[model samples]
Target: MTLTGHSLIAGEAVAGTEGRAFGINPSTNEQLEPAYGLVSTEQLRAATAAAADAFKPFSSLEPVRHARFLETIADNIEAIGDELIERASAETGLGAERLRGERARTTGQLRLFADVVRRGDFRGVRIDPALPDRTPLPRADIRLRQIPLGPVAVFGASNFPLAFSVAGGDTASAFAAGCPVIVKAHNAHPGTSELVGQAISRAVRDLELHPGVFSLVYGAGTSIGQELVADPAIKAVGFTGSRAGGTALMRTAAARPEPIPVYAEMSSINPVYVLPGAVRGDADALARQYVASVTGSSGQLCTSPGLLFVPAGEDGDRLADAVARALTGQAGQTMLTEGIASAWQQGFRSVESAAEVELLARGQAGTTANAPAPAIFSSNLDVFTGNRVLHEEIFGAASLIVRYKNVEDLAEATDLLEGQLTASVQATEEDYASAAALIPVLERKVGRIIINGWPTGVEVGHAMVHGGPYPATSAPSTTSVGTLAIHRFLRPVSYQNFPQELLPAPLQDANPWQVNRLVDGEAEIQPR
Candidate 1:
């Protein structure tokens, strides 16, 4: 596939008539060729209009057909092969091996949603058959099923270009939910976005689906993203980026005449609490794993453990020493972008200048413009509580270790944290009582809590939740990963006294889809 520097708008390779932007190689600090033209207001309107026009037919398609379409998209993405991986690596500075794994994760998520569609569980079909033969007040013949919430605007993420970009989970779940999607390509990886966008367009065409079923737009700044969110034709949005960007979209979506749901995955520190027993048992091994998680992907993941809580004593000192020793051999790595590198530097400076924070260790500095030196900082509970800036996300390979005097101090530190995508406890059986006490506090503070595990790698599955309350994401009830994410683009509609012909197949008495559904308050699996 050729890298056309054109936006895939309404199934056509429409050239953006606005200003142009080029993909920058973060590792080399060099601009990539074939400048991508930014989309104009008119083009944005046209794309949304096309998606709105396509929504009816797209959403009304049979469940089986929807499943097939999703599978086709997965196939098309895989067909892109090495070209996709190479472009993504060059554009974002992510290694080919990592890109290949991300590509598999992207396709795997698409196929998982396909299976979700085939199973028909996302429909949320429920039936309460009317009892006309009953008392004076007979129950009305009512059935409920989830319907698509029309067109969705997806924002490509800077990190994980393939897995979180144009054809990533947000788009996949939206498409699986039968909603038309218009993705705003991330500026950092325009070439990768173009390739994946073209692949999706090809799948839409090969399936003979609506041309407007998918579209990709490019922009140099926030104008296009804000306009896309404010468009009345867009019913919901999916975003993965910084807190400022996500909150800006949330405000825009909320201020619109007809407000829409914005599932914006924003910031997360993903705190890890190291219980005293666990820290005492094998601090060296724990330190090794902790350093690995923080340095993985240059600490670009949302679930990266940015803050670690440990008991202040011999155990804590041992852990800190182990981390310092581990940091000596670690080397600086190239981040996803120069802007991110700058932000990391600023965040590191903030931590370094804090009154009680101590710079425990520093890795070898990188020789390139976008490379960042990994650093570990330590502070006591008093200093951390007094300084809110210490809690902010650095967005790079930097973490802070907060030493607590006791379990109460640990709980206090945990309470001070903002909402996070995940919180982990490195504990053993002996620490269960202490770990159990922290679970309640963590439950309210984060979405997922892991025991004796790292929080960096997020698995896309049925029960996985890549979301949390408040700053972690715009909407806590919905997720941007896994099959449940389909609900973000869906709204339940109850059909009252509708004839079989007028009702959806899953809601009809025939139960054509043969899906498990609630009937009169009981779970039932009806035959086709």
Candidate 2:
């Protein structure tokens, strides 16, 4: 079967002018279809211009009307959620069940943004009353509101076709905030991206939005991404990919005359600390859970637990054996792309070269179409602390188990961990109490700290932060999940001496919206 999904520009599917990239199915190692060629400089300019122009009218729409548009998009996405997931699985080689769950999360995120708009939380409006005094001159009132950044460019990730692709969270948040989007589809799943892009197109028409509000382009090289971010019309960018790729685009954005904000959620190790008490009590269950987390989606998730810290003793040995057996029992599947598979192999070789690390069990290699079975390694904390490569993300179904001799050993390992999206602590109540001394140290190293849980399943809700310092993400203050993500699309604007008629609704004395906010120094739900 073959399918060619062309580039979408100005609400229309357009072919590339200069070059073409073939789409390779990771599941079969066979070419499925041809994707649109690299978007030339001219195409990038046109797309950027369309988005900039579209933003003017979209940003001017009333918040309520904007909220309705977002709801319509969510409705359209949900209506075709099944088809989206199926195609995503076929293209990217992810399992059907996992993709289905990701689809639900993706649509749920879109609706969450709708709810945020409906509640007027994103308005971020504030007002200070005018003051009249006899001894001093009268002062006019001050008002503040969120304004949309002009246009945003989004880069889809290879592992998550539906949730992080053309119509993913980055696009959904930008669209909900009244910022038009220009998406650069990942080559691994261009066909799936095209399908979802069409859904979004139908949505825009149904909601009576500008045709130029969205554009999806495809290219093999870095040129398209560079052109998009460097374009004067683009105001910001959202990216999820490797550090090398993200850093290149970030540098391009930073070099521009008017540097723009680039929110890039790069990869991470997402370490887990297994205390002695938990291992002593029930090492088997924790090992089984780790196996599932490590092999889930072939360890393609950015939050997969790559580096594990196990306490030393007879219990630690039992936990190691159980985890190794569990991973060996699970069958390995094809990765999202061949490039990823090759990289995984390269990482495996590197781990094999480490002197102190011992290979416990290695799954048999499969055909080129499938990845090798999961592998596990055992080592001491000394080796892990000495080698910086041990902390880097391997991006496959592989884990390194490090044994800690004492509290000091565990603390040393925790202190050396890089910034991560999640840090899991597997400990009994007593062990949890014992580790209280190291809790604050771990807190500063990760965005979210989990107890008796795996970090693979990221929930999309308020207070869900999928970002961390440095390698986990480029910006810690921003998050890729939840309604708070809309902040990326908004900037603050302050107004003074404005007439009552000219005042924004949120600043109006009527307090028509009745949204929760801070007034003076107190929390309230009324206009000044």
Candidate 3:
């Protein structure tokens, strides 16, 4: 499984004439080989055209074979083994242990989607029988089931190269929904993208699926990416990147003749609120955990707690001091790319220069090229609420702390904030009264609420939500993680007065797919 600089298009290794770019090792600032070839307009169109050609067969694949296809992708990715991990580590500065876990997540996501396909619940079946003799006007027989969108264009994220890249959640969900996919490999890790792209290609070959079911292309700049979204063949998009980047894609999709939906996870300043009783419970330990979450992955994670609220009193002072000490002992690690490190520095300086903010603590710098020192700042509720710059995400190992005089001030501060992926609350039983009052406010502003915990690690499961309103993600009704993400690529179709022989398998009277259905407003249970 050697790395090639070519793009994988419809099961073919297509060399790009557009341009070439190399993945750089952020830890050492060294160029990695071989230089990846960027796709031309012609090549990009070829991939999408292939995808459109594949949608008919790929979307209609039988349940058993479709599930096996996903499983085979996981097996092929595991077969790549150490070479995959080593290449990903070099391309991105993430540690080996972390990449190993991410690799498992990537494979686990594919396997999870495989299970979803086998169950066939994603088809979302419903039926209403004809009422022939009940009334003057007979009701017509109707059935409904979800169908796949034609094709999807997925943009990789810079932070999680494995779990958010080529064979990540977006691709897995789209495949589970039975849509073909075209992935635009993130520029920061082309070599890593190539490896995973090859694994998916192998899976397509092994299962004898349509060749265009999956395609991975490289882009030298924004032109190729924007063109992908504007292409008529692509019906929807899955994107995880900067807010600006996500919005740009959104605009392109909207400007198209046939506007499409762009499911983009842009930015978040996941906030943490520390109730008075909880601050009194274990200030020292809470401060340490807070700093740990801030500095994890050099604070590049989207869910990192960017803002923290503490009670204003003697107990709060003790907690603030603990936070300072904890931050001072911490150190930053190598970031994913030089560009990301540069942006983090710029954002940190802007927040540090604000007159209302006071520097609480600054940590030691890492012993690498792109790694920078971590820092924390402090202010009051008035300053945080009044200053718009203070409310923005710094996108690095920097955080801001604001003290509130009472529960009313805390609730007001929470109300003023923008949409977030998560909001964490540290509270004891004694503080539940105050914490309970703020729950509705948090429900309006964030997607997930955490009690007595941090917001760094995201669990991949059926009920987990990795999305939110507005700035957190473009689509408030959808999630970019877990099993529910499959709905992003599905659209419901209703059949009325149709013959039983013409009905799709899932909507058929006999339930040939063995999927559960809602029949005449009643549950029609089926064996798993």
Q: Best candidate, TM-score-wise?
A: 3
Error of 1 at 469 (Å): 1.1
In candidate 2, how many Å is residue 350 off?
0.3
lDDT winner: 3
How many clashes in candidate 2? 1
Q: lDDT for model 3, please.
A: 0.92
Q: What ordering of candidates by TM-score runs from best to worst?
A: 3, 1, 2
Q: How would you encode candidate 2's per-residue C-alpha lDDT over 131-183 as one tens digit per residue?
A: 76624677667778887898999999988887887877888889878799999
Candidates in order, TM-scores: namely 0.98, 0.95, 0.99
RMSD of each: 1.2, 2.3, 0.9
The parts of candidate 2 lying over 4 Å away from their true place are 1-4, 134-140, 366-368, 511-516, 526-528
User: In each prediction, how many residue pairs overlap at the backbone (N, C-alpha, C within less than 3 A)?
Assistant: 0, 1, 0
Model 3 C-alpha lDDT per residue in residues 11-107, reported as the tens digit of each score: 9999989889899999999998898899999999999999999999999899999999999999999999999999999988889999999999999
Between candidates 2 and 3, the lDDT winner: 3
Which pairs of residues have clashing backbones in candidate 1?
none
